[model samples]
Target: MNLAERLRRALDAPAPEDLLAGDLIEGASVTDGIVPAAVLVAITRRAEPGVLLTVRREHLRTHAGQVAFPGGRIDPEDQHAAAAALREAEEEIGLPASAVTLWGSADPYRTVTGYEVTPVLGAVDPDLPLSPHEAEVADWFEAPLAFLLDPANQRAIEAEFRGRMRTYYQIDWEGRRIWGATAAMLVNLSRRLNAWS
Candidate 1:
């Protein structure tokens, strides 16, 4: 089976009991009126697949200058999580929705920032051209899936936040540091895929 098919099957299966990043954040679930959001985990179809990621513009109000998947809050007009993800991808990276074939969605994640995010898994044409949105994205790049899935590449970093120590996972690619919600989602994906391997 193809990568997309394999992932779809795993993602569609029952949720596993693996610990999530949000669980580590103190009072992460105490937020009221959480908002709905979605992100596209767009993987390229190549001999060695890579995942597309973007760096947010430094001036953004939330998660500024952070590396993330192409996605945002679901709009009222969006049909569902997948539709929202596709729209966000096109708006952020100029990647046409036609260039992607969505498999399925992984488990929804609740962020400490009060956004419930659904990760839409999809495979895109490896050669599709991408033009980052200057207003939202600082730049865009791809990381090899094999490297991302390896547990050895995952690092734990901690610092005092709001007078309490908090830990998070990160994966260093070249000079890019992928951490926070982005890294957490990738960890979840890795667990799902690895369970089926």
Candidate 2:
């Protein structure tokens, strides 16, 4: 099957009941004033598929200099999460919405930061020339999908945040550390894909 078809099937599959779709820390909650956000998990359609990610500008106040997917809080005007993801991708990475083929959305992942993020999966041409927005994105790169989805590469780490011990998944690609909500969402995607397979 083609990449789009495969992605569609994977997304359509029901996530297992035990699958960790959100923050794993105890007492973490998204019930109070939860901000709805969406991210574009852009997969490159090529001989070796990859996932696109970005490093936020260090000067920014929130999540500065951290690796992240191209996205942000869903605006009130956005029709839905998918639209928001597409718009954010365009704004952050200069990736035109027209260039992406939407596969579907994955299960929503809640972060400790109080953002309930919906991940929109899409396929794009591997050779597309993407320009990063200077104010928000510092740099962008693609990591191989195989390496990212591998359970062996997803490492669990415990750290103190807000005076509480929390466990989160981390993936190291080259010198970049992909972790926290971003890595958790990738783990969710991996579970969905593996379930389909």
Best by TM-score: 2
In model 1, the number of clashes is 0
Candidate 1, superposed: residue stretches over 4 Å from native: 1-5, 21-24
> Could you give candidate 2's per-residue lDDT for residues 1-197 as a string of tens digits?
75445656888887866567677467755578888999999999887789999999999977788899999999999999999999999999999999999988899988777789999999999978999998999999999988898889999898988777888999999999999999998888877777888
Query: Model 1 Cα displacement at 105 (Å)?
Result: 0.3
Cα RMSD (Å) between model 2 and the true structure? 1.5
Q: For candidate 2, what is the lDDT?
A: 0.88
Each prediction's RMSD over C-alphas, in Å, is 1.7, 1.5
lDDT of 1 by residue, 110-175 (tens): 777778899999999886779999999999999998788787898878877676677888999999
Displacement of the residue 106 alpha carbon in candidate 1, Å? 0.5
CA deviation > 4 Å runs, candidate 2: 2-5
